[model samples]
Target: MKPCPVLSIALALALGLPVPARAQSAPGQGGPTVIRARDDALYRELGGQEAIRRFTDDFYDRMLKDARIAHFFDGINAAYLKGALADYFCVSAGGPCDYDGVSMHNAHAGLGITKGDFDALVEDLQQAMDAAGLPFATQNRLLARLAFHHRDIVTR
Candidate 1:
């Protein structure tokens, strides 16, 4: 079998992918983010699932090392998160992948996540995208799709 990746939305918020594992999370309790993709264009630009997996791998490393947000991932199974996150991103990018993780709201409930944390997470994601060699316009396009998820990740 192919090697799977680590954690997500912070895994994606970084895509707020910093939720508990499927066994521990609410398991698809919340609604999905509806992104109007122009027919897999974004997915292709993102280099497909392989590219996403690489970006996610780097993204998780960044989050775990960042003092500003690493605490949130304590004891979490990053491998499991990475798979779910890739699917979320694939779906967001218009690929034919199924997102089976919990809702953004459900994933981050009671985490006391603040706007600052969300921003930090997004920053890390941007850096990861940059490292992944994603073009400026392409990165912006993807980020725009994920922007709405902020409300769910950074609950007051």
Candidate 2:
């Protein structure tokens, strides 16, 4: 006789609850467990490289037009900026791309970037993510990773 699917699932869940192993061992006997890295959900969610490219383009376009952050980007080559952004995003989303751009501390070292400028850029990024139809959790995760570098990127 076969068990009902729901019943089987319920039983599995109930029996799978965490329990101490029966093997005798000294305290702290387990060796360090190596965790395998999971595939990047961001890449899957953003539809991969092409989508990342498009999003970077749109994000920079908006930044150039927005008065709030335009001054910070002034005199910066748009093509270079776009390429750098693509590289950053590609690495950020766990793609195989390598970012050869300068580190945040070196890139903005003398730029005197302020908190307001950083905030504006983040806002624009959020807009770009939303425009690309990214899920809220994915957007937040990406942003959180970027946010950690704010101290290095923002001089003021």
Candidate 3:
């Protein structure tokens, strides 16, 4: 499979390329893990926990309606999953969140997800971030960390 664009774009932005202003990981079991972060700059840019929660909700809504990947969540609980996703994103963005959820590798172990599914999900996230008023760079920052999980999530 081709590499996810999120990683490269995030690296470019981190390396000094500009991202247009817009609106919007880790591995293993742990008490609380933060993805390769030095600070909470992304958390701040994301407008904190409340905002994160909002976008996560929006993301799930989009995902549930998307035919390409909707089946993946067939037996899942929407409310609970949305909250978990919020916490996950919060932690991923370097916020003060204690995400005690399942690891990406474990959570998706038998899901049989594909590159298309992953990309569609990422697109849903961008839509959510856009709706939440996250700037381009902020979206990329969060995506950069989350994209690292592509290896863990895409099992197909």
Candidate 4:
């Protein structure tokens, strides 16, 4: 039995790649029509590299100002953090970039991050996306993908 296209798409997403196209039977018994999932171009829709940089910058700015999560970044270099995050987010969003930073688990290993902290950070990120004028749906799509990393992010 052949696997469903949905499964294929899920597999691609799990691998951090673009969603695969699905073949659906056309009307009137015509040949199958290719249905390309919007998720495949999510990185581009999120405005590619420059947009990710701006979004990352705004996010860190808010994070630094927010008392709830500010201490987590205390004494950290903002410029370097922003660049590394831009690369991380770009790759996570299926953009044309590679992330060479430490793994999420290894990076946050001893941060003592709690669920509340993670949730608050997510809130800050959403606000940053809002400030950047990213469409709500697109923001949610990206957030959903990021949410999958929660296990690796929160150690407390």
> Considering every candidate listed, which one attains the maximal TM-score?
3
**Poorest 10 consecutive residues by lDDT, candidate 3:** 17-26
Better of 2 and 3 by lDDT: 3
Q: Which numbered prediction scores highest in lDDT against the true structure?
A: 3
**How would you order the candidates by lDDT, starting with the best?**
3, 1, 4, 2
RMSD of each candidate relative to the true structure:
9.1, 15.3, 6.7, 13.4
- Off-target runs (Cα >4 Å) in candidate 1 are 1-28, 33-38
Alpha carbon lDDT of residue 36, candidate 2?
A: 13
lDDT of 4 by residue, 2-101 (tens): 3232333344346553243432334443232222233437788889999999999999999999899899998898888899888767766667665655
38-153, model 3: which lDDT tens digit per residue? 56778889999999998999999999999999999998999889988898787776688777677777778889998878878888888888878777667777777776566778
lDDT of the candidates, in the order given? 0.71, 0.63, 0.73, 0.68
Ranking by TM-score: 3, 1, 4, 2
Q: Model 1, range 1-156, lDDT digits (tens) per residue? A: 311122223333254222211222343666643443546888999999889989988988999999999999999999998787777777777777767677777888999998788777777877889888887667766666676577888887
Better of 1 and 3 by lDDT: 3
Error of 1 at 16 (Å): 20
**By the lDDT metric, which is better: model 2 or model 4?**
4
Worst 10 residues of 2 by lDDT: 29-38
Deviation of model 2 at 66, angstroms: 1.2
In the range 92-124, model 2's lDDT, one tens digit per residue, is: 656666565666666778888887787677667
